[model samples]
Target: MNNSPIHILLAEDEPSLAMIVKESLETRGLKISLFADGKSALQGFTKGNYDLVVLDVMMPEMNGFEVAQEIRAQDEEIPIMFLTAKSQTDDVLKGFHVGGNDYIKKPFSMEELIVRIHNLLNRKKLQQSSEQFRIGEFIFNFPQQRLIYKNNEPVKLTHREAHLLYHLWNNKNKVLDRSYILQKLWGSDDFFSGRSMDVFITKLRKKLNQDPTIEILNVRGYGYKLIIPST
Candidate 1:
């Protein structure tokens, strides 16, 4: 849609299908690099820069799940979408478990695929905008990964901690839905990632414990609320 091309990494073993998808997306102004195998896809991913990834689930040498996991291990925030013919719930769950941001079942319409990709990229942009947060006389600078107090004392935050806190502080005093948060931060709304988010929440609470006025409240089945007392 936009004249500015989005860099995309496409890992599909089927040449014809890959060509069709690549050409279709390219016509829409997306810049894509196609790989016929998962191994080559990952190798290219490691050596190149891409804004989004479309990985076929079944491939020789390596599978999409493994590749997604490896990518997540290095770049936690890159958007990843899985492409597979299988529509089984377990397979879909597995893709999300491996850090997939979204999944497209095979035989999908090109229109639908493009729409999903646009939505994912737009959502990522919105999240990035909310990375900076103001909370209880302190500013949480997510891009810098530091929390600065009024006195200018900066506290370094771990990757997960910074991301988790940024979301909470961005939605300060407002109820943030758990499912929305899990999907935005962890790239999935699965049980394990939910638990991991909980752990990060706890850690953030501890880190902010120094300022009793700043609190992270669990909304129980709903989500979390960050309470920043007004000075």
Candidate 2:
């Protein structure tokens, strides 16, 4: 939320699928480091501070389950998700056994993939020792869906509102493309999604009105921007 994007390490041998996934996540302001095989991906994970790791089951050098085992040994906290075509019971159990927090069968929609990633992240984030973000004078606890401002009653946020605010906070002081946001959050950038996004934005604006320095701007033909003046 402090202008640092969520860093993710992805191990995928399928070039087309990997490219599509990487670009999709990146469009949502995530930082993705892609590796073609398990060994390289494992190496990349060791060299990086990744918030999450996405592994493909079959690959040259090393397979995902094996890679996951190596990663689990080194860092037990980070979220690990498996991507594979195998829907067999044994493969599914093996993935979980190897420290995978979530699994998505191949031929999956981008929306499903994103949702699973968020679920894993939200679960893992709360499981960790700490997780907090600031918007003006307010403390936004995302996983709890609570927005606290001083001694006032906390404003409980809906699921969509929380996600919208999370994206806004991450890209604060910069324009967040409406289309990109719609696709990232609502899975489409159509008229209905745009209108829905607008309503959520309005609600966020009202809740954040306590701080005059904070503003969620409409960038005309482009998108929205959450402005926070430097203190």
Candidate 3:
């Protein structure tokens, strides 16, 4: 059994369900932080570094959608799952719109929940691994959160910068829609996040500018493209 467990943030109101789920996950080597209200959940989230978040849609003080939006504002990469009783199409749409990566309806089986959790974690791991790519004169290690330039020292990157660079590198030489990047990297394509992405792009450009053959071009009225010239 692996001891260094995955930490999960579980926001659910029902005491009985919360305890059961917590015990179930704990038995499987997962750690959980349970909150009965959305407000408390949000507060806890701000203070904790969780691997994934499981949110109940009908929590007190704030609904799952609102809490998800708030969380997405701070973190764009953390996987979010919605555990709610509501099964309406609109509700499902809202869940994903607010940054939910998975949605589990109520009356779910423990086995299924565990499987879903594992699947999400596995996908995230794969993504991180695939994100480590070689750009001209630079080797980006996304998991390590650094860019190694031509046998020189590794330049540490912030979480946002690393994530953004990963996305750009993943779609290298192709035009990446601006809104798509904002949503994928920042969890939202709103005005504030868009502005923030622009700033990050500028920073990344400066960092990668050391290599004359590499350029991140802004696609007029559309998106950005990371161009790596073949030597």
Candidate 4:
């Protein structure tokens, strides 16, 4: 429970329904960005940071399933909910197959919709908390904000350091785009923040260098990659 408003990307072609959904969520202190079709919704998704997406299945230009697939290609972690008139078993399966976290049938009650939204977000929060990442010989306990190695004294990390490490750890062995990292963690990719990120990376390197098998490699003008030995 963070009291901050949850930003949602809502794509529903029906104007009246969209207005009602928007008003309902806004009254509950949630921020909603409404788009009339799937393509516009995809654009909003890319340009704006969102906690979750609510997609109407039948839409012009593209559909909810297509939009969810496109969103999954970018960030698989973001939660997606599908709203559809079809409640067929096949349709529900298809939604889950396309990376939907939750499915809500059309003509649903406002209370039910809000409850499902909260539940999906809460589930994601729980997953993030329980996630334990292995970094070479170290265990990154994200919830505890501690880096534990060989069951020895754990290295306590500052909030920023822990957040940064979580991102790097999640993208281990992959060249994480610098702008993506900055935008996700620091909310900006400006010159000052970029320099600041470098400083944190250097500090992280020093902290993690005790194990020769662990390495954080810089990908030239791209980003940083966390490398951990396979064995």
Candidate 5:
């Protein structure tokens, strides 16, 4: 995983609603930059590094669709989710037409919003992940399923091992939920899958133990977190 918080750009005109959304997302461990208008949001997008963009459909100065167009021009892969009250089919189609990745109707639950945001982020990550990753002294090659260190023979990894390591690396510095990993790799989070994950986790730990600075920690009852300083 990257070594920074998930930063979000939010464009909402209503002060109360903006604050509520900001606080709610913050409590869930996200960093939000709130703007009161679409133009200001576009400006923020230009100046700030952000993981995702959430834009309210109706705003002064500009609208969500306009901002999305600008953002899409600048960064084609960044997730753009529209917060709209419009129920008309044309409006929904228009949002997608302007490069909106997803849209939620107004009066959405924090839970639903969180789920959508996670889904978008996950999809973007999978699509754009690099073929290789650096983990402390080791370089991980996802496509080749190999782990190489200094000039020595690379450590060959099984398909499952490579897949797991790639995801762990994708979410390095953040706690990766066990259920999420299980579902991605095993297709279900059943008891058997959980046990299988434990075995793989043990195998990975041993393989990576040569680097003292790198750790795949079991976050107690939650999940695993790969702790490695940026190289």
Candidate 6:
């Protein structure tokens, strides 16, 4: 996992700027996909896998805000960074309202962008580790990926699924950061992997649904929470 290269999706309309940013990030060994328009970027987002998304605010036919909204509908946890020349407070707030996690103004330095990306990724990684979790009548074995129910049946979990569950369970009563979960499970907070994680979470929810006391809650701007009924 540590050896895996981070994958990034860059949605910028300016061809020359996109190329420069893509090349700059690539030099750091990160995998980048460049899209010239919002439509193509959204389509690629649906079809391809990535770790993080870098979107330009002013784009043709479906601007970054619209694309972000669509992406959020499918995946509530992936990291989203907005890039735009608009510096007004209203514009920035609008980005956040549309589910943007971080914002970078246009004409920004490549070094600053790189640093911000690194910081966001690092922060995400720190939030995924959990000491233990109690789900319904089951106690999760984090390292082993097994759920031991009250009836003593041991439910096995896939590697990725287990990691996802661990993070949710660990954040039992709190908001679990979406970006952190993606980085922890898939090595990047990109669109595709984010969607994949959502699928895994749905499957996990179904498996645990048999226990009425267990529930996975979505916290809008934040992330997820695994609730355990009071004993």
Residue pairs with colliding backbones in model 6 are 50-190, 51-189, 51-190, 52-190
Candidate 1 lDDT over residue span 130-221, tens digit each: 56667777778776667887785788765456666766776878998999987765555776567667766887887777777888888998
Write down the lDDT of every candidate, Cα atoms only: 0.81, 0.83, 0.83, 0.82, 0.83, 0.77
Residue-level lDDT tens digits of model 5 in 1-231: 566889999999999989999999999899999999999999999999999999999999999999999998887667788898986766765676576766778898888788888977875666456578789899988766689886778997654577788889889999999999877665447665566678778889998888899999999888999999875
Candidate 5 lDDT score relative to the true structure: 0.83
Question: Residue 225 of candidate 4: its Cα lDDT?
Answer: 95
* Weakest lDDT window of 10 consecutive positions for candidate 1: 184-193
lDDT of 3 at 77: 71
RMSD of 2: 12.3
Candidate 6 residues 1-231, lDDT tens each?
A: 477799998999998899999999999999999899899999999998777889999999779999998887766556788888986766765676576667777799999899878865754454345444677778776655578777767886654466677667667777789888766544456654555557677878887877887788877766788887766
User: What's the lDDT of the predicted structure labeled candidate 1?
Assistant: 0.81
Off by over 4 Å in 3: 1-3, 132-231
User: What's the C-alpha lDDT at position 62 in model 4?
Assistant: 98
Per-residue C-alpha lDDT of model 4 across residues 74-103, encoded as one tens digit per residue: 876777888889867567656766767666
RMSD each, Å: 5.1, 12.3, 8.1, 15.1, 12.8, 9.6
Q: lDDT per residue, candidate 2, 114-137, as tens digits?
A: 887887677555534335688888
What C-alpha lDDT, on a 0 to 100 scale, does residue 196 get in candidate 5?
A: 63
Deviation (Å) of 35 in candidate 2: 0.2
Mark the 10 consecutive residues where model 3 has the least summed lDDT.
184-193
The local lDDT score (0 to 100) that residue 83 gets in candidate 2 is: 90
| TM-scores, each model vs. reference | 0.65, 0.56, 0.59, 0.57, 0.57, 0.57
Which 10 consecutive positions of candidate 5 have the poorest summed lDDT?
Answer: 184-193
